[model samples]
Target: MTQDAKIHHHVPDAAPPPPSSRWSHAVEAAGWLYVTGQLPTDPDRPEAALPPGIAEQAELCFANLARILAHAGYGFGDTVFVRIYLKEFARDFRAFNAVYARYFPDDGPLPSRTTVGVAALGRDALAEVDLVCFRQSGG
Candidate 1:
């Protein structure tokens, strides 16, 4: 018998999160939640302004990511894969690692990840992160 799969969309209500011209914010399929790249975006602020630095931006990005995950009924432990895009890899890698380690200490399965250097991102943010998480069945 083929099992039926359910899909869910997670959107936080406090602010209107912008959608990528290419995809939805998050899509769940076959028990897996796929989240789109999240940037340090303050919807209330003007897009021309940039956040202070990599670390601050990373934290905000993660906070946005976490909120999306939560809305989809998942958490950090459910993440099985992560991809990070960095506009200034050489200058920001170290600081990024410091913040990253705090989130995935002990390495434990440590969601397979790929960090790539990029020329730019939406709003010219320094870093952005995208993740995939598996929801525990019946949890």
Candidate 2:
């Protein structure tokens, strides 16, 4: 008989709660972690108002992503890829990049990324992000 790899559906207490019951914040299997899209929603007070401006909003999104990654024993260093959704791609792209560069420094390893303009996002947020991470062990 063969054994099957176990899967984990995680809703980290330190990360923002999922907006709906239909999804988890992250799902893990094998050596990979798939982090659901993170909005600027406050993890400690999810009902709070979102930050204003592209820089603040993007900062919040990265903060939220950081919390989710840490909860899974991962960090930006372990991130392999990222996908960002922006409400105003042309206007916010440069500002967002400024904030993003802070997390993935030029001297450090950076994850592959895709950023696209989106018509909408949950909570009417200006930005949202998701991550994909890989590790050698299933920790």
Candidate 3:
């Protein structure tokens, strides 16, 4: 962040964003916010158990991302791009898509997206997601 630039650091009140962590949940600069990848683990309670199945895990990942965007005064409607990671692509891709559509509906401007299959994720989470957003003026 520079002195003449308006930058915002966020820690999503809804999810709380991993207490005292070294990384920021989201950072805003020049009307854009770069959100960090969100795992299915509960940021509000690190010790809490994770949700089972890809559908639930995928939903949680989006929920966590939503909180980060909301904290920074943005939303999915502001999103320009999204990236998703899946641990079991063969088994869970369809289920993940179903959950993903609920949050990112086709009725609106769909953000450009990429979904990658991964061997594993932090805390053994089945999925993770991150976003890049452009905040519209007065929105």
Query: Which 10 successive residues of model 1 have the least lDDT summed?
Result: 13-22
TM-score of each: 0.85, 0.88, 0.87
lDDT tens digits by residue: candidate 3, 64-104: 88788777888888999999999998899999999988888
Which sections of candidate 3 miss by over 4 Å? 1-8, 12-21
Candidate 2: misplaced stretches above 4 Å? 1-6, 15-19
- How many clashing residue pairs are found in candidate 2? 0
Q: What is residue 89's positional error in candidate 2, in angstroms? A: 0.5
Highest TM-score: give the candidate number: 2
Model 1 per-residue lDDT tens digits across residues 39-98? 887644535366879999998778778778778888888889999999999999999988
Of 1 and 2, the candidate ranking higher by lDDT: 2
Error of 3 at 55 (Å): 1.0
So what's the TM-score on candidate 1?
0.85
* Model 1, position 69: C-alpha lDDT score: 79
Model 2 residue 99 CA deviation in Å: 0.9
In terms of lDDT, model 1 sits at 0.80
- Report backbone clashes per prediction: 0, 0, 0
